[model samples]
Target: MATEQPRSSGSNTQRPLTSALAQHTQKKQWKDLSTPEKVVTATKTTTNYAVIATGAVLVAAIGYAIVSELFGSNSDTRIFGDALEKVRNNDQLQEIIGTPMMGHGEASSSKRRRNRRIHSQVVLDAEGKEHLLMRFYVEGPDNEGIAHLEMVKDQRNKWEYKYLFVDIPGGVRRAQRIFVEYNKDAGLPAIDDK
Candidate 1:
């Protein structure tokens, strides 16, 4: 052939391919560069994981401590029970056991009639102190009701009455009366009257 064939205009020239190959080779060299670099990367990842785990553990421990302190009976129940027993044995309770602290005497008397067996008892408070309790079986009418009281003693030997009203369909006010009477009878100062 006399004249050389004209170079194809649509061909991908060698220059672009060579440059791409050089870039890939450089990247490979970067990967093989150093062990220390890899160790630093791994250390960063591990440290982040450790920090997150520690934070989670601390949060859990704090939550548990709060719940236990607030709700745990530890020893308050026994103290509350002892204080209530003391109140029960007091002379004033005997005198006011059948009397109404508020409202008409006739209505209170009627309610007592309907609920012949008004009873109460004390359990320990959640903290294991003597101020916690459960109450059941009260007497009352629409406006005059009876409640059981649980008492606790402070360091000064003063009694604190915790009031629990028996389930009466429409006698909450009456239940309050009963609570007040219990306190008055127990010889504890009435905070409300003050």
Candidate 2:
């Protein structure tokens, strides 16, 4: 007859070497760590924060650039606003097109196209000067017309109008073109700087 041996319970078994190493390397709370371990942990935390802060700053810069380019004083939207103001204030234009004028971009059948983008381009001439050419539409109670504008950068780096005109189509009378500004000496054409 063989003598029966007692079996040890699973809880009394020794953990494997890999499991023991994993437990040894597991991250402890800040207060439980030795001074050297705390230093390494702090360094990793600071690096992670720095990386997150850098990404946030990059996103902010991109957002600012987009907003400034869309709404800044030198932007196409600002140019359209200035041109619309001129059309509204002109006595001849008011007489022909009527008061309470409305200005917009291209004509569209979509009534929700309120924020339509104005057509514009920037070009460089033979004199190495910059020019902004743009087009928009103007409407009134009785008439509607197309407004074309060209602006050049002056010596002070400010935009000055080279030419601005409005063309009104006619049914009973001949088509009329009105010039709000016409600088004959600028001698700059709308050359595409492709």
Candidate 3:
């Protein structure tokens, strides 16, 4: 009988296949690692931590910007809210526009008024005062009108009303204006002035 040869020892005959990017690496104890390998491992760990930290900071910045835009004291949305509150609570406005008044941006055909953008602007005057100007629409069961408002910041950085009024245009009758707050000496003539 011929002598049988073992087939299990095939490392020399069959070489393990690998690609440049996916070469197999064996795990080694820290003490067994070379100086270059240890440095590469540390660098990779630092890079991963750096990427995570950068992502966290970016997310936090975006969150802060959104919050400030919607809820900050000087934000347009906040000013719109304050003006709408004054309009809704005014007894004269309720009498003119009828009860259950609603405020919105420019007139639109769509019934969804919540998404409308309130038209507003902020400027610095020659007197070194900040001015906020805004215009919006108000509607009620009986009528509709356009509201204009101007506010100036006081020495304490608080908003003080310069003028707030509504104009109602009529079809069969003449137009009308209802003043909620007006400061005649602040560059604009009084209503009764010629």
Q: Flag the better candidate by lDDT, 1 or 3.
A: 3
**lDDT minimum window of 10 residues, candidate 2:** 185-194
Please estimate how well model 3 matches the true structure, expressed as its whole-model Cα lDDT. Answer: 0.85
- The window of 10 residues in a row where model 3 has the poorest summed lDDT is 185-194
Candidates 1 and 3 compared by TM-score, better number: 3
Instruction: Return the TM-score for candidate 1, rounded to 2 decimals.
Output: 0.28
- lDDT of residue 168 for candidate 1: 29
lDDT of 2 by residue, 35-153 (tens): 99899988999999999999999999999989988789888877788889988998888988998999998889997879876889999988789999999999998788999999898
Clashing pairs in 2: none
Clashes of each: 22, 0, 0
Candidate 1 displacement at residue 163 in angstroms: 19
Give each model a TM-score: 0.28, 0.71, 0.74
Candidate 3 lDDT over residue span 56-175, tens digit each:
999999999999999999888898888888888888889878879888887778886568888988899997778889999999998889999998876557677899999988875568
lDDT of 2: 0.86
Per-residue lDDT over 1-194 for candidate 1, one digit per residue giving the tens place of the 0 to 100 score: 59987576786674444676677755434477488867876798899999999999999999998876455543333333343444344344334342332212123345446423223344555655555343333222222233344566444445455453322234323322323324423333346645
